[model samples]
Target: MLLLSRPMAPSNVVLLLIGLHGTGKSTFAKAATGQDVKVNPTGGVDAYTKECNKYTVDFKQRRFIIIDTPGMADQNTIEENLDVLQQVADQLQNLDQERVNGVIYFHSIEGARLSGVDRDNIRILKKICGDEFFPRVAFVTTRWDRIRRSEWDPILVPRNRDLETERMKLLPNGPSIFRFLNDGESHKAVLDYFAGLEDGTAANRGDKKARRSGTG
Candidate 1:
């Protein structure tokens, strides 16, 4: 239903996904869009590592233009991170009528603690999305299925809270944090979370390349 790929009209909502490489952004895109929507890495099926891909969601009375962007390396890829953010910004700027409705920044929960690299990545992301766009941004913790329920109960939940705390330090305006399983329900949850909110716009017009010294 979101097939009006040429240019978004006033009724459309442009959604964006941004995160570090291998954090399961593409995987979530494929699972969430289903077989009907075309997932990128356009060869045959489910190939990751493309620059950018677009998918659509047709709900009861709403349409969404989901932009899946390539993952950025938080370690030593300052230029690459800048390029990817620019790519997303360019696509968002193309919307003449609509504006960025929401953003999902993924964080894999495989690690036990947030490192300096993680801090750097979130800084760059904040820079890209601007300072006041937190209400529209959701920090989604991905790879939940990979963690054991027992471990989650004893370890993961606490760690997630700690991450949230640290996240607030960097992104004081960052919106709520949620866990994602990449399932049908999780997809709906993501949509519903944003659907409840008005289409909030993000002001990211300048060329604010995150500095290499965004080090933790």
Candidate 2:
């Protein structure tokens, strides 16, 4: 079966979004891509996004191609996640500089700390992308508007610190962290970081495709 709804053009800068279930991958995708994506509300309770959805937009004279992948979790079974990963892996191999640009990893404050599934998913990501892919990854904590600074000291601060200290090892040298759905333009800031890396060329290491695990 085809993973993408439509054919990806050569000029698209593909950005893959992955995170734990309920991390608001869909919400962030909608906000960042400016596309009214259809998010399942009932069956969505588990996978939310049953399949990978691609949204294309124009940003800063460059095409912003966002691939919103299904959230990874245990409830859906390891087989389910693997199936999606296989499709993603197969698709990425065909894309060049016009392909994958970076990874946007989403986390949430609703949890007391990152869960086991979260850690497992990160491991899978590392396996697929390889160590060098770390620099292109962005670790983002979404849904920050749920609380205020006063409410964070006893709750969100320790959690955040622990994530950066231990959990962030998912990305080598620790990928840059950001607050999405909280501060305005934070999403743009991430894309901007990659944009600056352009250096008037996309043929360098900056444009190289990420490594993926063999599927099948």
Candidate 3:
């Protein structure tokens, strides 16, 4: 597994977690990196918000920087929100391109129902990052513990349909989609996904490459 074999500490790679407030971005980050994780909430960016929080974890000799930005939807203009995302992009760009890795986009499983605000925020993110950014994006639907199977099935059915429709329209050949339970079994899937990335597992490598190459 990726987590098991990960370098004692990995350096030069950073993972940014993005999502709305109450979506569990911080929680997931903590789970992924453990304690000692740095969290700098948005502060000094504007009067409305503070600077964003950045946490670092050392694993397998590599230092993984995790950045958490405030929910953009709650902010005023699309431009202002984009500015925050841009700052993140700039920071990532400054890193060694080859070493800089991925982004985990979090969404509450209980809140997966698409909303106008979500659509707008997603559009803004895609616009700023471009289509190639798809490979680096991972959608994390959290709060599984709060949902029952009966409630989940029905909700996810339509939600997945809407997501597929939107992806087909906006990102026909986008990033890989892996579901995380956000509960008891959360670590398994998430760890596997991260491991796949680290070891370049055949399935993950092939699938992501195909998507990036526009052949999938």
| RMSD for each of the candidates | 9.5, 8.7, 8.4
TM-score of each: 0.74, 0.73, 0.64
Cα lDDT tens digits for candidate 3, 1-216: 001122334533456677666566766666666765333333122322233566666554445666655655554466666676766555544542212355666666555465555666678756656676555556665565455667655676456445555645654544444445544345334434444556565243222332232212
Error in Å for residue 20 of model 2: 2.0
Off by over 4 Å in 2: 1-11, 40-44, 76-80, 90-98, 182-184, 200-216
Task: Name the lDDT of candidate 1.
Answer: 0.60
**Which is the better candidate, 2 or 3, if ranked by lDDT?**
2
Cα lDDT for residue 149, model 1? 68
Instruction: Please give the lDDT score at residue 47 for candidate 2.
Output: 54
Residue by residue across 1-216, what tens digits does model 1's lDDT show? Answer: 012122245555567787777677776777766744333333222336555567877753567778787766656466656666776666545543224666777788886666556667667766655776666676777777666667766787777778777667776765546666654566555665565554443222100111111101
The candidate scoring highest on TM-score is 1
Cα misplacement distance, residue 89 of candidate 1 (Å)? 3.5
User: Tens digits of per-residue lDDT for model 2 on 1-216?
Assistant: 223211255445568888766677777777777788765443235756766777877776667778887777646555676676776666555443224667777888666666766676667767766777666666776666666757666776566667666545666444445556434355665565555444343322211121111000
Ranking by lDDT: 2, 1, 3
Model 1 misplacement above 4 A: 1-10, 36-47, 90-99, 199-216
Q: Each model's C-alpha lDDT?
A: 0.60, 0.61, 0.53
Would you list the rank order by TM-score, best first?
1, 2, 3
In terms of lDDT, the poorest run of 10 residues in model 1 is 206-215
